[model samples]
Target: MRVTILGSGTNLHPRRAAAGYLVKTDNLFLMDFGPRTLSNLLKTSADRHQIQYLLFTHYHADHFSDFITFFFDAVCHSKFVSPRADLRIIGPKGTKALFGTILRTFPSFNDSEFRVTLKEVSTRSFSIGSTRVTPVPVTHTDRQTCLGYRITFQGRTLAYSGDATYAPNLIRLCRDVDLAILDCSFPKNRPGEAHMHAGECGRVAQEAGVKRLVLSHFYPIADRFDVKKHAAQVFRGKIIRARDCMTLSV
Candidate 1:
């Protein structure tokens, strides 16, 4: 299994990062479609049409804003085509509603000939193609129902902590996974409502016994947070501070 960090910035863009990831096993799958997702994937020579599944972690604009572009390209652009025979989108309870909103929001792109399937997932394990996906609710903003996911394929597991603080369920969901892609949104000293700090991630990583810990979702202020120095104090595993387009083989 290969995992690529399409975008690792926080809510802010250009200066900070937006959330996006690409997981592929011959068949491409995308995790969060934040701003500039398609553009970033293009930078890696990945075709948008090759994406067989779109798994959303939450409904936050920073996490799902670029979905509009994907929908538009799927409908209007004939150059891109899905190799997996179908495009399956899996998200939280409001996934169907959100998918409809995106299509309705763009009238010009509504005249598509392709069919897009939207599946609303809950805190349960399900399958998308050959991949086994498990969604675990996380504590993010109160306005939306947020979730993180543990995906398993061919005996390898990848746990992604979408956007959450230190939640016990997240720890359990990620336990013993091959790779843990966690949300290190802020630094140690800087606290936020719905994001995790590097220190917090370290503690979770140690408890979960994750084989590798990849910290992402960096903010502009992250440079001043000394995440590497602080996170090292807690986690004794392989730690990587993710950058845009960083790829990992698991």
Candidate 2:
């Protein structure tokens, strides 16, 4: 499996983009759709039209904002040229309602030529093409549903922590995976609410026994500290700091 970091920074970070990732195996799979998601993906070998499935972790603006442009701009443009196959979107509970509201607000979105299917998922496992996806509920805002995804394709497992604090569900989702892409939003010294620091991420990586840990969702404050060094203090496994446009083979 191949994974690309489309955007790895938090909402507050100016230089780095927001949270988003693109995975390629049998098909293109996207996790989260933050501000720079489409733009960053365009820089790579892939584009928004190539994405087969889109999995959202939560409805936070930093994570799901780009969906507006993706649907309106890309899908609309593709419709005039050559509409691709169905674009399947899976997310936590209320996803269908959310998209319904979007369509209600802008009814013109329903006039698209391309097909879009939205599926609201919970703590369940399902398959999309060759990939098996499992959503593990995690702790975040009380107002909205949050989850981390464990994706298995071609015998390789990749776990992504959307926006979570220290939760047991996250640990279970990451267990013995090929790659654990965690939310290291803050540095160890500046721990924030509903987010994990480098040391905490190290603990999760260590406890989960993931083969490799890629720390993402970095806040600007974390720029002052050595994130990998801090995570290395607790985790003995390989650690990588995620950057926009960085691609890795898992």
- Candidate 2 displacement at residue 31 in angstroms: 0.3
Q: Write the per-residue lDDT of candidate 1 for residues 36-124, one digit (tens) a residue.
A: 76677888877777777999988888888887877766766653553223578889999988777776677765556666788988787
Off by over 4 Å in 1: 79-85
Colliding residue pairs in candidate 2: none
Error of 1 at 62 (Å): 0.5
Candidate 2 ranges with C-alpha deviation above 4 Å: none
Model 1's TM-score against the true structure: 0.93
- TM-score of each predicted structure versus truth: 0.93, 0.96
Model 2, TM vs. native: 0.96
What are the lDDT scores of the predictions, listed in order?
0.83, 0.88
Worst 10 residues of 2 by lDDT: 103-112
Give the RMSD in angstroms, all C-alphas superposed, for model 2.
1.2
For candidate 2, what is the lDDT? 0.88
Best by lDDT: 2
